[model samples]
Each structure stands twice: as structure tokens, then as C-alpha cells.
Target: MKLETTHASADVASEVVFEAKGLKKEYDDGRVHALRGVNFRITQGEFVVILGPSGCGKTTLLQMLGALAEPSAGILHYRGKSLADLADPASYRAREIGIIFQAFHLLPTFTAVENVQMPMFETDRPAAERTERAVELLKLVALGHRLDHFPSKLSGGEKQRVAIARSLANGPTVLLADEPTGNLDSENSKKILELIIRLRREQNMTLVLVTHDLNIARMATRTIEMKDGLIVADQQVPQTAA
Candidate 1:
């Protein structure tokens, strides 16, 4: 199945959310190269999937996009401003980017609603407002009835839904998901994918998802194939009826 996209072509110059030029990430005294002079631009409202085998630097690239790690060399920009020049990179990450991981990293002791409210603690929002927003997000993810349930009491799919709700707590513009469905069964994977697509459609959020599965790659508005720390292929996904 193909994903529905707003743009007729990837070349559409609406707005650039992210741009990387000669992006490189090295580790262990420059002995390990996670990204090698990678360069690409992700436009606002685009769903771009990064595909490759293990150790191909897809995750590293995602980390850079999420601002979880800094590049060793080259330039990384957000909204035409250099990431390194940001006054507070952490604030940018917390406010602008939402990240989902394969493990559904929910706190075992916290209830679903509490977990969803965790990100808001970083801001100065009132406690009551935080609770209200958390509940709204949980409802959006179809977990309103499970709001009081702990992570241990929820099913895998429910846990993932909680994670998804938590990722939106700060109202991020970009969502970065790494192997979001890798731990779920096929049916659950489909449910999560559908939820993501729906959220993107509703919010016009930019998405960068990393996965080894071709089926998941096919659901993106654009597919970017990475290999040996470099981008090998970048193409637009064909449009499909909503």
C-alpha cells in the first residue's frame, strides 16, 4: 500500500525544515564513522523514511535530526539556522522534535496519562494545563479509557499508543521514529502505522522514520535509502488516494 502525500513532487519548495550539508558523525577518536558527509533536505510536512540494513547509519542520521547527538563535522540546520548556533539546543529538541523508539520507553510505574505528561515537566506550563493536554493527547491516540492504567497493565499495542501520545506532549513539529513497529506483531504494526499517518495528516507534521522493512518504507511520502554511512537513493513515493 502507498502512502497519501500532499506534494506532487519532492522538488516542491514550500519550506525547508531540515538541511544537512557534509554531515559527518565520528566516534572513538574518529575511528568509527557513523555518518559520512551525508547531505539532504527534508521539507515541512514530508514523511521521509530512512531504509537500510544494520550499521548503515540510519539511526545515527536520525539522532542528528533529533538533536540527540552533535555531528563531528559538517553543517546541520533547522529552519535555515545552524544547529550548532542555537542558543539552547536542548530547548529546541524538547520543543520542536518528538521521538519514538522501538522499545516504547514508558516508565513502568507511571500511569498512561502520567507518562504522556512527562515531557511537559520540562516547560513552565501549569500542572493543571499539563494534565488537560495529556488527557487530550491520550484521547487522540485512542487511549482515553486506558489513561489510569500502568504500563505493565497495558498490552503491547496500548503501550505503544501511550508512547505515541507522550511524543506529542510538547506539540512538536517533527516526529522522529526509529523502528517504531519492530517490536510489535504485523497487526499492531499496521495499527501504529495508521495512527501515525492520521496524526501527520491532521497536524501536517514532518516525519522521519527509520526501518529495515520495505513494507514500512512503502508507506512514506519519500524513501531515502542509506548504505555504509551514505545516502544511496532518495525518491518520492507515488501518491495514493486518501
Candidate 2:
């Protein structure tokens, strides 16, 4: 199973980061299917949008990619290695994959900076280094002034910004975002999208974002549309020039 390799810099960024074959996820003793025999390859630095309506299995597929959930039947490989082979999925998640949910799952007790540092503890980085890095990330997302603010104190947009910073704490190679703008207002949603795009460019990150917004899907270089637990369409779209 040899994959095409490329030269250094931008060329090497074309290598596959994730590959799936016959991927399926089921529930209730196979009575409910979330993902149905999906197959795809996501390359490094690719911006992929999983577009579909509610209950279309986009989130389920994303969970599998992040190793938060296992596939019921089929192989899910990350960088050519099966996710099932990973001895510690937690480590894989903390150090390799970053996930952002729409809920802005920030701990109510922690400040913005503290929430960002939370992921680094799992990677066992030095305490001081974690705090320093967290501060840098928050500042990058324009939340430096709000470092001491807790989730309850921050606005919807600000909280989501903190979540984005927290997701990048470990410098993950890939970022999976599930309906990140669902809870945001139009103005905030545009801001969040811009921030994400900027970070993606600066980091040269591989991003898989799940959204039902057709306009949002147009921003992706490629889009995979899921329906009734299956990928009904997958095709190229105009890439965002930003």
C-alpha cells in the first residue's frame, strides 16, 4: 500500500493524512447506522468541508477521524497507520489531532488561558511552558485581553475563540471542527471563519470541517456531502483565495 510521496516544503504537504475504506458506524446492535461504508483520503494541508443536513452522519465521520469514536466496520488509517493500532488514543488526540465543537466546551471554572493550557497537560509539557504557549495562542486568536475571563463571562464569539486556541494547544497536525459557527451570529461567524482560515494558512494545517452551510462549503477546496449515513457527493469546489 504505497502512497505517492512528494518533495519537501509545499510539495510534501500533499501527502495523505487520513484514509478510510468501507468505513461504517452503527448503534443499537446495528439497528441504527451513522456512517455507511464511507471512503476518502484527506491530504495534508487540505481544507475539506463535510456538508449535509441534520442527522447525516457528518459528525460521526469526524469523530472517527479524531479517534474519539471507533468505526463499526472498516479500516481508518491516519498517516497510513490504522487508528486501531494506536496504543493510546488519548495521546493520539492530545498530540496529533485537535477537535473543536460548536458548544465551545470550555470548563466553567477555568479562564480562557487555563482552558487553552488544559490540552497541554495531557501531552506532559512543562507547566510553565504550557501557560506560556497557551497565552501565545490566545493572543493569536485575539483573546489576550480576555485571558482571565471564564466561559460564563465571555460572549459566544469570544468563547469560541478560546475553544479554537485550546484546540491548537498541542500543535496538532490536523484540526476537526464540528459546526463551529452554528452558535455564532452572522458577524461572529464571519469573524470565526476568517480567524480559522488565517490560522490554517499560517500553520499549514489539514482541516476537516463539518457544516451544513452551502456558502461555507464553497470556501473549501473540496467538499464531501453526506446523506442518510452515506456520502452522496464528493467533489471539488473553488478554493478560498484568502
Candidate 3:
């Protein structure tokens, strides 16, 4: 199925996953305008990739979308409600968003399974159930065999897989990945992208990926190109036949 501009429209159904209108950001005492009235919408189960050159504010926009950073101006709605309306953004993030970073950001001291189970501490699930879920998620990322391996022991790809499993621990509806394959070799990068696409297909989750790689952007159903902190091109690529 193809995505449309109306996808970001406010009249969209309540099930719409994420929407941003007239978004703007500034820094350095208004010396830098990171975003200039940016706007976009993302729906549930859709994979949207944002592509940009350096200093285009891709990371800033992603941070805002993930609720890690607030927009200097504009409105962002999640599940049909404004983010500003949320009584607690931290709690919302814990429950609804999964953020993956390029660094993998795994605990050096914690084993793979422990890293995956970390989020469960904030949750009320029993320890046994948390362990089981972490194991299952690791297996989903094909890292069950390295469940006990520390970050230093696993290869870069394996570490990223572990991070992915950790991101999935909470079963978030939206997954925001920032340059997830940035540090990997070509083969490993392809593997990581395939894993993300497979997981999106299986879970029917909403995915917003920020990447510099054109090839990586092509994998997404829709590509939104940003420049100077504004969306210069938003295009839907033709899907390949089955």
C-alpha cells in the first residue's frame, strides 16, 4: 500500500501513531534555527525513513518525535493526543516508545540478557517473567546463543542485536532508530537493516529511521529528505512485486 500526504492530517483516525505540525526548533540563543516550521505524520505499522546530510536537524527532529527533546514550537500528537497534554512524558516514553542509538549503548558490565531485562525493572512484571521475555526477545534477534555474553565479547553486529532486543523488551508501538547501522561493516549493516525490516513486518510496528545511507533509506516504504532543518522532499517509492 502507498502512503499519502493526508497521512499526517489532523482528521486522521485516532489510531494514527504520530503527527507533527508546524514544528520548529532553535538553539544558540536563536543564532541557529534547527527546524523551520517542519511538519509530518506517521501512521501505525508504517516504516518512514528520514534522510539528510550533516547538520540538517534529523537527529533533533527524531529526538523531538521520540519525546527525548521538546520542540521549541509546534504540536506533536501521539495516539491522537498532544504530547503536551500527557501528564507524564517519561512514563509515556517508557510505555510506548523504543529508542535505538548508533552506539548500541549497552552496559559494559551487564551481559546481553541483563541488558535486555533492564527495562523490566521499571515495570511491575515478575522477575521470572521478565527473564523469559528477555530471552524470547534475544532469540527473536538471533542472539539467544549469546545471552550471557558481555558487550565486549560480542561482535559489533551482535551488540546491536542485543540492543534491538533490549528496545523490544517493552513491546513499544513506535520504534525510533538513529543510524543503527552506522558502525557496522557493509555485510553486518545489511543484516541489521534486514533484521529491522523483518521485525517491523512481524510486529506491524511504526518505525521512524534516521540515516545518511541512501541504500538504507531506499529500504523504507517512504523517504523524507531534510535539508537545512526542513523537509525538502517527501516521496513514496514504488514497492517491488512479490
All models: lDDT? 0.88, 0.87, 0.84
Number of the candidate with higher lDDT, 1 or 2: 1
lDDT of 1 by residue, 1-242 (tens): 22222233243346898999999999999999989999999998889999999999999999999888899999999888988788888888778888999999999989999999998898988999999888888998888899899999998889999999898888787899999999999999999999987897677789899999999888888999999899999999986722
**Model 3 Cα lDDT, one tens digit per residue, 27-123:** 9888999998888888777788999998999999999888887888899898878886788888777767788899999999999999999877878
Output the lDDT of residue 241, model 3: 10
Q: Which ten residues in a row have the lowest lDDT in candidate 3?
A: 1-10
In terms of TM-score, the best-performing candidate is 2
Ranking by TM-score: 2, 1, 3
Quick one: best lDDT, which candidate?
Answer: 1
Clash pairs, candidate 1, are none
- Candidate 2's residue-wise lDDT over 1-113, tens digit each? 11111223375387899999999999999999998899999998888999998998999999999998999999999988999789999989988878899999999999999
Candidate closer to the true structure by TM-score (higher is better), 2 or 3:
2
TM-score for model 3?
Answer: 0.92
| Model 3 RMSD, rounded to 1 decimal | 5.0
| Model 3 lDDT at residue 186 | 97
| Model 2 regions more than 4 Å off | 1-12, 240-242
| TM-score of each model, in listed order | 0.93, 0.94, 0.92
